[model samples]
Target: MRWLLLIWLILWGTGVEVRAQAMSRPKNLILMIADGCGPASITMARDYARAVLGRKELALDAIQVGAVRTGSVSSRVTDSAASATAYACGVKTYNGAIAVDTAGRPLATLLEAAKARGMATGLVVTSRITHATPAAFVAHVPRRAMESEIAVQMLDQRVDVLLGGGWAYFLPAAEGGRRADHRNLLREAEKAGYQVVRTAADFRNGVRRPVLGLFGPDHLPYEIDRNPQAVPSLAEMTRTAIALLKEDPEGFFLMVEGSRIDHAGHANDAAAHVLEVLAYDEAVAVALDFARRDGQTLVVSVADHEAGGLSLGRNVDGRGIYDWRPEVLARVQASHERLIPALRQSDRPDSLLRAWLGLDSLRAEEQALVRQATVKPDRWPVVLTELIGRRAVVGWTTNGHTAVDVNLYAFGPGAERLVGSFENDELGRLLAELMGFDLSSLTTTLRQQQPVGESR
Candidate 1:
């Protein structure tokens, strides 16, 4: 009986490779990263979307599998650098390093491996391309602080498509930055067989080869504040990157990160966070639309962690808190741009009138009371920060990072392999297997046991 079971497991239907073999490796890999996303963050976004759409959103509804664990390599607690490293290099390293081992040894990123396998590679993010999360995939450093140096690493890797910000890191230090490089990355990339494009028009005009685009000096503008006439929305960025990468016949790996979602949450600005989340969801919709039509592509969406400890401050059902009308949320967000800016610059009620908001602008005396509004935040259901989220019916737990299990959503071929709980590092391994690269080929060893998410 034991031999029969072993035979079934090892040689089932000879034509079909069971276990890791049955599913054909992904020809195209689209990894959607929500920088500071956790289950709570996703749940909050989902509920917010449901209220406005009056139904399950197609972006999240395509989720066929969800995971429960998201720990970094060194400890139960993790930061973006460590977390991103987990996914960038299958083997886990210290908390602040990227694509390196615990002994401070640098390892090859999935992008480098994919490129070696004759696959095209691309990176897209709302954050700077040199940011820790994006850097993990192509840059090896002992510390994430080497962001500028890491920019050179990305350049050195010769990734087919590089989009996002961090131009400051690539420019000479005299230009108001710490970077030591004087070489123009865009020009260098072009010289090294990459076409450099910086505007929407660049994407509009089709290109015949790999392209490198830098849209901003640091991280790209937050989705809420980005001028549509200038920077492309997250969805547009995703769609354009896809079109470019898909042209490669050897298949491609594209990493699109919705970075500012976490940035907004980190600021404890609820309204901003909601907008960022929406922007990311729109990008997800773009990816799914492509995958659904392509049939051969595999799309995986997950977060590195959760930010601002976001959770409902007031239980809507328990406290009679009702969902904010979508229009109301939109108005609030627009209003705050003018309102909050003044609020941040003010100290008391005496200057309350300073707010450009049409609301009863507080007089000097009123400003005094308004300034006090931030007090006793723990006792109240709202605050200036909460006001941001409340307009969208979004709430938060605190204004800092927390240990939590982020979400994992997947679709298309090979997605079934992600149906169960796994660690953050395993995600890297899974991608390795899905891409037809033997995990060992990268020359990294990862624990076989799955890492569990904080939520579980």
Candidate 2:
């Protein structure tokens, strides 16, 4: 036995055996997207988790193999739709494209290919199920805003598990929904044998295969504003999706998105951003735990782009020194979305000022800014964001996405494919290869196909 072990070690050490071992395919793939979570955003979240939440380390920090360039075909800074398309379809499309090439032609996505090869496919997101990120995986459209059409395509694709918000898109106009066609997609989904779940209870109780869960009318509430009784956490949705998809012996492909991290970043709300990242990290923990136990799964976590150009440390006292106050961030009780509505509803801004700011005492100037924000409906978010950033020691360059390379973290079988720097589109090709799919054939077939309204 000792001699056999020695021979195995020798073989492993040799370049020949190492190459073969590294080429091994993963039976299952879990692609987790922390939308707009860049390096600085991650640093702020990590520090806050350690200082305030008492966490020793984040699951994401453990498996960070390297960074990946996130440029789209149309722009250096990519949007959620285009980046997701690149990750899902092995091609770089325009910013608004969803599972389509730059010419508006449909592209066979990773989930479609996985399903074609007898693998169970699932999508779990904190955003609308038909939103850009998740839509890119299974739906082909010229624009990401065609979510109602995306919902139809989702059903057409026969995805095994569909979970997240966007209930409005599924319901018809007659049912007080945003759909223009008056077609009740929820009924159509039910007729097609999906166990549709709407609330937290339904999600927990409806544990069967072919489950469809839409928790909110739009994107689910931010983690800081979420009610546990009404909505499920990202971690909960991840576990449920894994449970359903893993039952397939042929293996599975699942995409989970921490969708609202981008929104909080856009708002430049540092407290809310950290909370969303922590929520995303919890989902990461779930995936890592499952991958470790399954051993045949490849778990990859990445970001689409960097939003807000977030900087962790702010200049303090005009002394050229930077500082971050985790305690100030810890005092935040609600998200900007929640606080804004409350401010609008309440006539007494002065009484609710300090509590809403989450600070024990606010400077006179800060108090004056908050008072002005409450009265000035147009400048409310900007002023509040500034107040939050000043107190928490966070700084933002812009309230939009930035052209920055995002970090990539991977573990388990085929994790080697994710290491080192590469274009965002290359990730899709690597993932296709990892799943043992012929990318050349898939691309050729998809390109040959024309758009819905285009004449051949």
Candidate 3:
């Protein structure tokens, strides 16, 4: 989907932009974006990370970092389309245009330049590969919804690696696909010399040729909701993409996105949000593992925007008010999730609702109404909000992208350049320069200490 700029936000806060200062040449560039991940999500991630590691260690906190204003060229409140385009094209276009400039002209992306420079390129996302964030790297579409046509364009880019869902658009309608052209993307990619694969086993055991991996028909399943049969986790894709792309001697530029963070936010599912963030964190670990081992890779993790400004903390109660006990809180969500689907799906929701909630005195419609009121978001249930609506201190805001500054965290060479405020597009230029390309997108300097690997 395209990033939409819905609101014109006034610039707030006190940080000036930084020019590209490449402190060291990185042999490989792994760029990861947690889609719709805003400041609240970052805080939630740190809290979850601290809880999981049983210590205060977030890869984010280690970096020389700063905030970047994530608004699109046209509006302050950015969608993924314009945001991704800004960074990928280095020139912002109106929302929904991909790889095209503000004037609607196609321009080369950092990936294209890298390919021309004999560098390998890979694009990975939990969202469809045709989704705006990934498409901005190589596609120039008048609109983002043209997924079937976008699939055809993938063959033209000659990218070394492509991994994500959206197989429905690759196959024919007769074969349960969506391609009006009726082209078999898998075979076409292979005929073009890519080693196409459809499963984890295929990906893991397959030979290293340029690869096309279509794991699912749309977005990959969320970590907390997926079965191995449907879609692999983001970490699996990351590890596999790194392994395949790094084999090239010219080095590689890899874009890995954790898409479901945005989905969780849209659904206002706090638990799912935290779980997906942790999943992305695992992928982060995968990239960092490769970077540290290679000793020449630069890893930067940033979010395009904030979704569902989240707040998490215990609420007070007693003589006054307080959160239900932890054990009781868990029970509330569990029972509700088990009960809501039947209520929404049953031929007689009111009757079933009466049986489920055990309030026989209530009328059928009232029972149905209560069930509906309990799950304001969607087909699932969450206890976090019952706490919030009751004045408990746990909830999220907006349930949509906000015009908030996103954190830029980096590690490895040139990361020192990340120490202050900067625009998201400047990151595009910095990556271009570090991989030894001239973006002409922005001018940044090397660290005061100088970039390493000059002699190599």
Candidate 4:
């Protein structure tokens, strides 16, 4: 066994292709996407894990193969919609396109192809089930903002397992949903033979096919603010999805996303970002464990794009600080978004910060900033993050996506196919090849089934 492993490593390092006959195609595929995680994000998480949690390394540390270039057809930086579409369809499209080509024509995605081949398919995410990354796999709309339409199409696809938030998009306005179309998709889902679940308890108890688990009305709570009793964590959802999908004899395809790491990055909250990445790593561990046990499974984890331009070391007041303090972030108990609301309602806002941020005492300037932001609601998050970030010695260049390349990790069968740096679309094509799915033929058939000029 050691000799065979050494031979495999030698072949991989030397760029010598092993014959197809010598390799077995994976019977199951698990694709995990960290929506806006980047190299710096991983470093921050690792530092926190080692310094505070006393862990040696992350689950992803052992399986990292290479990096992936994240750019869209329209710009060097990519958004969730186009970047996810690149992975789902193996094609480049505009920034807002969802599983559509640059021409606004619907394209077949890997999930669709897997379903066509009689495999069970599932999507698990921390974002709304109708959000960009997950939507790219099961629904094709011209715009990512058309979440109502996206929700309709997801049910039409009949994905075996659907787990996430965005229950509002599935119901009508009269029924406390955001939809103006007056369609109760929850009822529609029930009529279609789906077991709709809404709480962590119900989700755990469920053992049926075609399960739709919407734990919240919008995106699920950030890990810093998550209630384990009310909402299932990303790892829990991934474990459940695997349990349901692996029952299929033909094979299965599942996409699991750590959706809100991007949200924390956009807020430039180092404390929140650290917790989100740790949550995502936990989910990665779940996938890796299942893959290790089920040798016929292929597990690939990658980020679509980097967000916030996160920097580990920061220069303070013209003084070059050569150190970062992850211990400061370890003291944070809630996300800044959660604190903003508390700030708005509390008359003694300083007391709120003292309790939640573990700040026993604040400097005069820090107290003043909180007072000013207390009066001005718009600056609430700004002051909160500023206080935390300065202590942590972390900085962010921009509150948006960056063109920087992101790391890729893979394990299980055919992981060798993704061992080198490449474009995001190229990675998509490789994924299809590893699964032995003809994406080009699938796309052609989809185009023929629906006329090119039809509404997307």
Query: Which candidate comes out best when scored by lDDT?
Result: 4
Q: Which ten residues in a row are the worst by lDDT in model 1?
A: 447-456
The lDDT of each candidate is 0.71, 0.87, 0.69, 0.91
**TM-score leader:** 4
lDDT by residue (tens digit), candidate 1, 184-267: 655567778887766767666665457677777778877667788778788987888888788889988889999988887777
Q: Against the true structure, what is every candidate's RMSD?
A: 6.5, 4.0, 11.9, 4.7
> Worst 10-residue stretch by lDDT in candidate 3?
8-17
lDDT of 3 by residue, 1-456 (tens): 122332222121111122223336787888888887777676666765665446575555666377777877777887787778777756666777776667555656777767777889999888888888888887767677877767777778888888888888889988888878777877778788988878877776764758888888777766656676656678888898888888889888898998878877776665566667778878888998899889889998888888876655543333433332222222222233345566556666545544543334544444454566555536234433443223324466665777888888788888886778777777666666666676443212211222321210
Q: Between candidates 2 and 3, which one is better according to lDDT?
A: 2
Candidate 4 structure quality by residue, lDDT tens digits, 86-128: 9998988889899999998888999999999999999999999
Per-prediction TM-score: 0.83, 0.93, 0.79, 0.94
Error of 2 at 156 (Å): 0.6
Q: The CA-based lDDT of model 2 is what? A: 0.87
Question: Model 4 scores what on Cα lDDT?
Answer: 0.91
Identify the superior model by lDDT, candidate 1 or candidate 4: 4
Which lDDT value does model 1 have at 300?
Answer: 92
